[model samples]
Target: MKTIALLVVLTVVAADIEFYKTANDNYDIKALIANATELQAFLDCFQDRAPCSELTASYKKNIPEAVVQACKKCNPSQKHMFRQFLEGVKKVVPKEYNEFRQKFDPENKYFDALEKELSKF
Candidate 1:
């Protein structure tokens, strides 16, 4: 019982240990934007849309935060758009449930690197 309790305590503490590179609450995001831009470019290319640049910029500006009142209202493209948005938080965020998303296949490696890089925002 003591061991289990200790393990639980450690797990909780570990989750709170913000690695220096990945700390957002302690670090400023504006400084991270340069790194964030690279991932955005790659995604913009993958999505192969001209407006991807503008959409990404709007997302960076937090326009969606005002627009997306509910989770379900988030559409497929919006999720796609968000995967691009979370580039700064990728390292901290867990992988998604989608089997197709769980591993790198086709553009998966690229997208994984892309997501990993994106989460730096």
Candidate 2:
């Protein structure tokens, strides 16, 4: 039973890493705008009062309090995409890409570090 559970955990971790890579690979503004609807739906999962309240709660448990507080202002409404949301956070907090990733991109690897990623903009 323990072995099976370990395998399951590893599998989920691997899948998450792959997803993280794909998300970062398509992190351009144009791609974000093109997939606005889908991206909004994804962000809605983490916003307050959404269907994924439990998941949001889980994130609140893991990430820093400051990150959660900043997220309130960074909340991307129906008018935004993932990229726009990041830009908003950049405007408000200035260099919180890692904090933003903690909620949206928890895996944290597979892309540039926070400074390198932000420099591209």
Candidate 2 regions with alpha-carbon error over 4 angstroms: 1-30, 52-85, 88-121
Q: What would the per-residue lDDT of candidate 1 be over residues 7-75, giving only the tens digit for each residue?
A: 999999767743211112232333443465554453343344334454345443332232232222333
Task: Please report the candidate that would top TM-score against the real structure.
Answer: 2
Candidate 1 wrongly placed segments (more than 4 Å): 1-37, 40-55, 61-73, 84-88, 92-121
Score residue 69 of candidate 2 by CA lDDT.
Answer: 34
TM-score of each: 0.23, 0.26
Report the poorest 10 consecutive residues by lDDT, candidate 2. Answer: 18-27
Please give, for residues 1-108, the per-residue lDDT of candidate 2 as tens digits. 999999999998766631111112233444443565643443455443245445334433422332333322222221133335456545544444444566545565
